[model samples]
Target: MDVPEALYLPDGDGFTATALTIGPWDAAHQHAGPPAALLLRAAEQASGIDGGQTVRLAYDILGPVPVGPVQVRTSVLRPGRRVELVEAALSAGNDRPLMRLSAWRMRSRGDAAPATPLTHPAPAGPEESRPERAAFFTTEVAYHRALEWRFAAGTFNGPGPAIAWTRPECALVAGETMTPLQHLLVMTDAASGISATLDWTRATFANVDLSVALHRPPRGEWLGMDAATVHGGTGAAQCNALLFDADGPIGRSSQSLFVEPR
Candidate 1:
């Protein structure tokens, strides 16, 4: 409805912390916190139990994470009964690791059977669609204004490779409610920078790594992102995604872009 009050906090059993502040669209020189669902809310506040139900989520970008004071160290690593596994690490002091995660917290068992009817290719409804605020990418336009995007073709002006269809005007927190896997990692990396090239003046990218995988968690919240940008020249690039939640295709995310040339 109107959420955004979990800047990450909770350090104890297993661990859960977030202060290495850096959000004006993040990418603090590269990337630190506040995205990827604030490291899944510091792994659901070290899995203290709240909106329970994730199934599986993993992340590893052990490279660029520097801004100031940050810590997240969760641990459960499998306590199956209804399935539970947690392992997080986002240190920023020791300067050794940057990000590492492992999730699979669950406790849902209510499927009556008789469910099979889904479709895809429906992403242009944000009142019609008007996403192109190119102002030299002001932090990717304030992180795409927190979602509700539309660009089912390719035209962010430059970089190359794009296909959009996001949704998240706000709705993802666990301690209360709403958990479509935290908006599927917040729009699954929002259509990685240009798939090929359309001349947005040139191109520019920076995203060391990212990974996501879910397959039967979402059922609502109109989620569906079929991204691309499979490869880029020299500088370095790679993006791939396939996540839908309209009752079909549950998840898949990948990123490793780092292009440059503007």
Candidate 2:
């Protein structure tokens, strides 16, 4: 499927979205339907913001989104004078909320006050490394054409840290134009958890909650992700990542994951 067309799926109703189940995790795809991406699009469309502008998107996965039909409902929390605040919830049967998201829409204020560039060095590009098919990446994630991902280090057996590079195939979805934030959101899942990537051969991981923050828009189309699972012991794990553009680091994302032995 092409990037634009692949980003969303068709519900039995007129509304189209990404199906609850797609490649890799077997769970619903994030930012697919009733996901963060859908919320952002609905807000933009409602507020009459051309999908090309900048809007901050955040998602809180309260629980598993279940595999089945879903619907998205959006509300404008506060249509501010300078900024617009919007909230979206995804529900299955009876409108039970599966995911709740809020977006901050505002006109670009341009660059921030000048400061020294002290970000970390850029990681190696995906092209420099050899390509390998991850069981999750190729089958579950459905990222085949959207990104050129390479697992820098990790065993296929168990939970642990993993590194990979991601570059978007298409811009992002917002009406008629693509935005940089869409690229960041699409690749945020590249290498999620540490325990899940370990070579132990008997661990499983699923993101319970995830969020990404962008400091500056991506300079180039290609962005790299360096991710690690930090400290999680009591049935929970946290995955953190730094996003890098050609110039330097641009954003970061982290997720709280549920861990168990398969």
Clashes of each: 9, 16
> Number of the top candidate by lDDT?
2
Q: What global local distance difference test value does model 2 have?
A: 0.57
Candidate lDDT values, in order: 0.57, 0.57
> Model 1 over residues 136-245: C-alpha lDDT tens digits?
34343234344455666555555555556555654333244435666667667555642444333465565666777664677676566666675445777677867776
TM, every model: 0.32, 0.74
Cα-lDDT of candidate 1: 0.57
> Which run of 10 residues does model 2 get worst, by summed lDDT?
14-23
| Number of the predicted model whose TM-score against the real structure is largest | 2
For candidate 1, the TM-score is: 0.32
- Measured with C-alpha atoms, the lDDT of residue 52 in candidate 2 is 30
Model 1 segments more than 4 A misplaced: 1-54, 58-78, 88-95, 105-113, 122-191, 194-203, 208-225, 228-248, 252-262
